[model samples]
Target: MSAVAGKAAERVAQEVPAVQFRPKKIRTVAYASAALLVVVFAVVGWLLGDTPTGVIFRTSDQIAMALLGVVLAGAVLLLARPRVRADAEGVEVRNPVTSYKFAWADVLKVSFPDGAPWARLEFPEDEYVSIMAVQAVDREHAVAAVRALRELHKAATR
Candidate 1:
């Protein structure tokens, strides 16, 4: 019984799970977009005041509310909200724009380059996907994620 328990503990210690990655700070594009949203809202407020975008007597309160909706929508897009996960069987990448799950068997290559926000993967059919969710945020975390993913890929190939 003790031998079995000891083996289980060793296996548990050996297995390391993969984690998601994201940008450390807001992306440059996101900042620019946010700024643009604010500017447009400001301009609209100035030009169409107290009329609810054309009427009259809207007051500052209504104008502020109208601008708030625009800001909220902009924030949602610029954030690039997404998640990435990997396991022995496969990897799942998700975001507001796209989501995909791939078995290790389908993956052919993984690479990370300098100046890139994240890693990327190549597969059969000449298809490719960004590993941004895995490598965008930090160097240490990204490397770890890559190494872990490589292991899974190799296993799947076998």
Candidate 2:
């Protein structure tokens, strides 16, 4: 490349910041789901075990119920894992299968939903993106990311 062209390229590269990934940690969903599973298991166990007609339920049946309880608990814990990250360049929202990258300029809005396990973002194109991983497990982290992103946006503009 010519020296002038190379210098121009270097200048452009320096102007655009690099992306930094800050993963979202959402704990509430994970813990709450496990709790719900435990409650269900307890109710089922009581009905299946100590009831007066106990002979009908049997020990083997209880074991099967316990196994089901375990599976439910595991599911809840897995669902509670965080999946959101953000950095200097932009925000990255990830679900189990898909991930989207939005630069500070593209992010139009960030909304924290009440009684929901994820945060949603609206883009300039009018499409919606979910930062569910973080919302599911660490909402405070998600909020902090949004705040950080706002600052990043301001810096980029200036």
Candidate 3:
């Protein structure tokens, strides 16, 4: 390659910034709701009296109920786990229960369709990976993340 072309390529590579993205509104809501659920459940368990059939509610039963609430809160907190990391080399997308990593060559584009819940990384053969971290509820933040990822993909592929 020509010297100017090499310099331009180097510049482009240097311009690619590493980024980590996470849903703002969803994460905040998830944390708040989880905390609230745990508190409510624990309070109810502690104050629980007897059953309608006159069966007494034992301390063990109360403890078990509190534990159940903790478990449920943990499950609810999973909604905040989605994240995306991207750089010039590739991107990593982590949804609630699944994760995907793709090199620039494997990613054809970054798209956020109208009325979609989140952004996505397009691949060959019409395949794509959803990026839940960049959620529609985040609005401008999601748009900026998608644009940054697209720019990184372009620079890497070029």
Candidate 4:
């Protein structure tokens, strides 16, 4: 084989390692927002002394308000839960409310179309799995992840 051809073959032979992808900015924002919400709710609840109708706010009421804030914060944290894990064996996509696992053979391609919010794994029969972890907002990070995933898919399919 020619030297150039041999080097290209060697490059292809190098295995793509397992990787996990998650939205960076979104996760940071989610965590900060959750903390802020909890603190604000707790402070407001504690400062609640009397209602406009002369009804006094009890300790239990304060606790309940704080707890409500915690609950809301938990909901906000869900936005940070999306993740994608890929390896030689397969890929797993975990969206905010759903999860999917697919072997490399099952995925036809990794695609991020123009104006798409996130990447997706296309399959046979027009089905596809959205990869929320690789979001458009992440820009270069998302591009690299999709490229790595495509390389893995290419190698596995061969």
Candidate 5:
């Protein structure tokens, strides 16, 4: 490549902002919640183990409860895991059940409205995507994340 072309490539690369957001605080909570669920199930099993019911029934009951605990823990962990990433080209959002990607030009606005559960990215045609990673539960951290994304959006649009 020519020297001028190389310099232009470098400039373009430098202009692309690297921004990432994730539900760190919520993940911690998820871990704790899963642990609590396990403990509660254990306690319940112990308490019910000595019941006068037949051994087969008791065993099946305990097994069912154990399976339920595992399922619930897994669900909690997955639901709380969210991430958002943006570069000069576009943004990606990862929620519990789905992921989406959007070009910077398509993003019209970013908002974290008062009393809302999480932030959102508005696009044209009145459509929007939820940002589960920037949650209200994280409070200040969530706000900072939304602000950083908005700033990046402005710079990219410019």
Candidate 6:
């Protein structure tokens, strides 16, 4: 590369600011899900133990129900976690199943286009990556996040 091109790339790489976004609703949902799981397990245990024809609940069964509640709550909490972090070098997206890192130069656009379930980055090879942290349920907050990402992308490219 030419000296001018290298210096320009260096400047772009150094000047872009870092930003992170995460959904606000996830915390509320996670807590509610955990509480609901516990309640459901307790109700089921009580109902089974109380019914005349139902098999008597053993102490071990109660313990198992408690464990099941805890496991379900943990799974719900895990599913709710999503985060996005972007800096001069690249953007890192963490969703429930996997995470991805994409350099600024490779991301052509950042958008939460109409009808899209979440924010997404338009990249090379006709690829689009989801930013699950910016959810549609959050509405305006999600829009603001997408705008911020677009600005960051433009700054890094320039």
**Each candidate's root-mean-square deviation in Å?**
6.4, 6.0, 3.3, 5.8, 3.6, 2.9
Which candidate achieves the best lDDT against the true structure? 4
Off by over 4 Å in 1: 1-18, 27-78
lDDT of 6 by residue, 1-158 (tens): 68976786577656756788888787688889888998898777656556677567787787788778878888888757889998766789999788999977889999777888788989878889888999998888888788778877887787
For model 5, give the 10-residue run with minimal summed lDDT: 4-13
**For model 1, what is the error of residue 17's alpha carbon versus the real structure, in angstroms, after optimal superposition?**
3.1
Q: Worst 10-residue stretch by lDDT in candidate 3?
A: 4-13
lDDT of each structure?
0.66, 0.62, 0.87, 0.88, 0.81, 0.82
Instruction: Give the per-residue lDDT digits (tens) of candidate 1, residues 1-158.
Output: 38865564345335645545555444555666776777776666666653545557455755795587477657656466655677655688775477889866678877776787778788888778986666456677678777867776665455
Q: Candidate 6: give its CA RMSD in angstroms.
A: 2.9
Q: Taking the tens digit of each residue's C-alpha lDDT, what string does model 3 give over 1-158?
A: 68966685567668887889999999899999889888988888888765577778999888888888899889989999999998766899999999988877788899999999999998889988899999999989998998888888888778
Clash pairs, model 6 backbone:
none
For all predicted structures, in order, the TM-scores are 0.59, 0.53, 0.89, 0.87, 0.81, 0.83
* Residue 88 lDDT in candidate 5: 61
Q: Over the stretch 37-146, how does candidate 4's per-residue lDDT look in tens digits?
A: 99999998988865577778899999999999999999999999999998766799999989999878789999998999999999899998899999999999999999
Candidate 2 vs 4: which has more lDDT: 4
Candidate 2 backbone collisions, by pair: 24-84, 25-138, 26-137, 26-138, 27-137, 27-138, 83-133
**For candidate 5, what's the RMSD?**
3.6
**TM-score, predicted candidate 6 vs. hidden true structure:** 0.83
Winner of 2 and 3 under lDDT: 3
Question: Number of clashes in every candidate structure?
Answer: 3, 7, 0, 0, 0, 0
Query: Distance (Å) between predicted and true CA of 89, model 2?
Result: 4.0
Q: In angstroms, how far off is 134's CA in candidate 5?
A: 0.7
Segments in model 2 whose C-alpha atoms lie over 4 Å from true places: 1-29, 32-36, 39-50, 95-118, 133-143, 153-158
User: Which 10-residue window of candidate 1 scores lowest in summed lDDT?
Assistant: 8-17
